[model samples]
Target: MPENILVIGGGPAGLHAANELAELGVSVSLVERDAFIGGNPKKFKYKFLFPDLQPAENVIGELIKKAESNKNIRIYYSSEVTDFKENGKKFDVTIKSPKGTETKTFNSVIVATGFEHFDPATDSKYSYQLFDDVIDIKDLEKMMGEGNFNRPSNGKPPRNVAIILCVGSRDRHVGNQYCSRVCCTVSVKQAIELKEHFPEMEVYIFYMDIRTYGFYEDLYWKAMEEHDVQIVKGRVAEITSGPDNTVICKGEDTLLRGPFEIPFDMVVLASGMEGGPQSPEMSKKLGIELDEHGFLKPANITLSPFKSNKDGIFLAGACTGPKAIVDAIVEGGAAAMNAYIYAKKNAQ
Candidate 1:
C-alpha cells in the first residue's frame, strides 16, 4: 500500500514537501487554511529581491500548477487541522473545512504554517492605528498592489516616504529578541520600487544596522549607489502626525549623536515576522514543542533541518525560523524526504 502522509499549511513549505514526497510515490494530502494554496507570497504584486523583480502571482501560479499535475498529491483549501492524536503507529488527524469536519489516518505529518507580521500596536510611539497614514510594510504592499499609494487623508502622491526598520524585532522591551532576517532586504526592495514609481520622491530608511548578507549585499549596494536611497543609522523613537497630513519621524542619529525629526508625507513601519496566529493552537494539537521565540524547534539543527521531536512529525520554512524563499523551498524538500523515510520505515 502507498504510505499515507499529511502535509499541513499549503504554503511554499507544505506544497514543496508534498510535491517531493509524491514524486517518491507517497500518498500526500496538503491542507491549507486559506482558499488559495500560496501563503503570504501570493499577497504581493511583485517581489523585488535583487537580480530579478518577478511577479509573486506568477511564481505561486507555477507552483500551484505543478502540485495540481502531480498524481500522488491531493490538495484541500479552506481547511484547517483541528485535532491530532497518535493511535498505535499512525496519526488520527481531524480537519475542519467549510463542508464539515473529517478525520483521516496518516503515517506522518509535516507542519509548514509559515509566519505572520508582528503587530505594531503595542508601541504607542509608532501610533499604528491612531494615524491613518501610518502603515506597516505588508499593508503598504497591499495598498501598492491595489494602486492606492496616495495618503488616505489627501488624494495626493506622497512627496516624502520614511521606512522604519526593526519595529517589532530585536527589541527586548517588546519581547521579540530574534532578528527577522528579511526585513532589511524587504525595506530596500520597497524603497527601490518607490523610487521607480516616483522618481522625484524622497525615500529614507531608518535602520540600526543594514543586514544584507550573501548575494543580498549586492542589492543593498545597488539601492544605495544606483537608487540613491537615504540610509539613516538610527532607531526611530516616535512618529507624530502633523496638520498637513504629514508625519514627523523622530530618532537619534547614532553616528552624529543628536536627535532629529524628518517630516514625511507617509510613514511605513517595517514590522518583524513571527509564527502564525494559529501556531500555538496547532503546536498544542500536535504536541510539538516551540522555542522561547515561539517558532518550532527542529529536532537537530546540524543533522536535520525538518525533523521534529515527535517521531512522525516534521517542520519546514518560517515555522522553524526565518528564511528566504530559496531557503524555504530547500527546507520544504528536506521535510518531505524526512516524512518519506518515516512512512517507508513504518510501512516495512
Candidate 2:
C-alpha cells in the first residue's frame, strides 16, 4: 500500500499541506474542527489582507477549492480526532464528525490547529462590548467585508478614529507578554484602509511601538507618507464614553511624556492572538508539547519548528505561534515536505 498521511485543522496551513501531499500520490486524510475548510479567515469574513490590500477570497477561497478538488484527499468537516494511539511506526486515529466515527491508520500527522483572536471582552478597560463604537481590528475587518465602514453606534461616517495597538498583547496586565507578530502590520493596514474609505476623516494610531517588520515596514511608510496616517507613541490606559457620543482614550505619550485623554468618533483596538483552548486540548490528546503561551511547542524552535516533539507528528501555521496568512501557508508547505519525507522513508 502507498504511504498515507493525516492533516489536522483545515485552515490555510492544513489545506495547503493536504493538497501538496495528495499531489505526491499519497492518500491524505484532512480533519477540521469547524464545519467549513477556510478556517478563521473565512469564518471571520475578512474582506482584504495586509501588505497589499488583496481580497481575502483570492487567498483562502483558492485553498478551499484546491483541497476539495484533490482526488486523493478525504476531508472530514466539523470533526476532530477523538482518539490517537501510536501503533508501531504508524498511528491509529479515530475521527468523529457529523457523518459519525471512523478510524484510520496513517504514517505521519501534521497539526495546524491555528489560533483564536484575543477577545477584547476579557479586558474590560477597552470598553469593547460595552460600547458598540469601541471595536477591534477583526471587528473592523468583518465590517469592511460587509461594506460597512460607518460608525457602529450612530451608523454615520466617523469624523475621527483612533486605532490602538497592542491591546491584549505585549502587556503584563493582560498576561500576554510576547508580541503577537501580526497585529502591528495588520493595524497599519487597517489604518490605511480606513483613511482611504473616508478621506476627510482623521486617523491616528496609538502604539508603544510600531513593529511592521521586514517588507511589512513598507506598508507603515505608505500609510504615513501616502495616506497621511498619523502614529502616536503611547499606550491607552483606559477607554470611557465621552460627551457628544464619542469614546475617550486616556493615554500617556511616551515620546513627549504627557498624559492626554483624546476623544474620537470610533476606537479600534488591535487585539493580539491566543492559542485558545484547542492548543492545550491537542497537546493532551496528541501527546505533544504545548508552550506557556498556549501554542504547540516545536521539537526545536530554531532548527525544526515544523517537527513536533513526537516522532510521527509535525507542526505548522499559527498553531505554533502568531503569524501572517502568508507565513502560515508557507509553513504549511514546509511541514508537508517534512511529513512526506518521513512517511516515504517509513513506507517500507
Candidate 3:
C-alpha cells in the first residue's frame, strides 16, 4: 500500500502541500472546513494581490485547479478532523463531513489552516459596521472583487477616502502587538487602485508607520509618487459622524504636535490578521502548542517553522503566523518535502 498522508485546511498552503505530496506518489486526504477550497482569499473574494497587483484568481484558481485534478488526492469538502490519535509512528484520524463520518489511518499530517481577518467592528474606535462608509480592507477587497467601488452609505463615488493602517495591529489596547506583515502594502495597493478607478477623487493614508518592508516598498512609493496619495502620520483616535454625511477622523498630528478632525466620504480600515478560533481548536484536537500571539507554535521558530511539536505532524502558512501568500506557498512546499521524507522512512 502507498504511504497515506492527511492534510487539513484547503487553503493555499494546504492545497500546495497536498498537490506536491500527491505528485510524490503519496495518497493524500485533504479536509477543508469550507464547502469549497481557496480559503479566505476565496471567501473574501479578493480582487488583486499587493506588491505586483496581480489578479488573485491567477494564483488561487490555479492551486484549486491543480488540487482538484490530482489523481492521488481525495478532497473531503466541508469536513473536519473530529478525532485524532497517534498510532505508534503513524496515526488514526476520523473525518466528519456533510455526507457522513469516516475514519482513516495516515502516515503523516500537515496542518495548513489559515488565518482570519481581524474584525474592525470589535475595536469600537474605528466605528466599523456602525457607519456604512466605515469599512475594512477585506470589505473593500470584496467590493473591488465584485467590481463595485462606491460608498456603502449612499452608493455613490466617494470624493475623498481615508485608508487607515494597523487598525487591529500593533495596538496594546487590542492585545495584538505584532505587526501584520501585509497590511501596509495592501493598503498602498488599494490606494493605487482607488486612484486608478477614480482619478478625480482624493486618496489619503493615515498610518503611524508605513511598514512596506522589502520590495513591497515599491508599491508604497508608487502610491505616493505616481498616484499622489497623501499620507498623514498619525493614528486616528476615534471615528464619529460628521456634517454632510461624512465620517470625522479625530486625532493628533504627531508630526506637527497639534490636534485635528478631518472628515472623509469613506474610511477603509486596514485590519490585521489573527489565528482565529481554528488555532485553539486545532491545538486541542491535534495536541499542538499555540503561541502567545494565538498562532500555532512550531517546534523551532528558526530552524524548522514547519515542524510541529508532535512527530509526523507539520505546520505551514498563516496558521503559524501572519505571512504573505508567497511565503505560505513556499512553506507548503517545504512542509510537503519534510512530510514525504518522514512518511517514506517510517513506512509500515
Every model's Cα RMSD, please?
Answer: 1.7, 0.9, 0.7
Output the worst ten-in-a-row residue range by lDDT, candidate 3.
171-180
User: Which residue pairs in candidate 3 collide?
Assistant: none
Residue range 204-309, candidate 3, lDDT tens digits: 9998999999999999999999999999989999999999999999898899999989999999999999999999999999999999999999999999999999
Candidates' C-alpha lDDT: 0.84, 0.92, 0.94
What's the true lDDT of residue 79 in model 1?
91
lDDT of 2: 0.92
**lDDT of candidate 2 over 1-348, digit per residue (tens):** 778899999999999999999989999999998889999999999888877889999999999999999889999999999999998888999999999999899999999999999999999889899998999988999999998999999899999999999988987877889899899998889888888899888999998888999999999999999999989998898999898999999989998999989999999999999998999999999999999888999999999999999988999999999999998999999999999999988877
Q: For model 1, give the RMSD to the true fold.
A: 1.7
- In model 3, the runs with Cα more than 4 Å from the true position are none
**Whole-structure CA lDDT of model 3:** 0.94
Report the alpha-carbon TM-score of model 1 versus the true structure.
Answer: 0.95
Total backbone clashes of model 3? Answer: 0
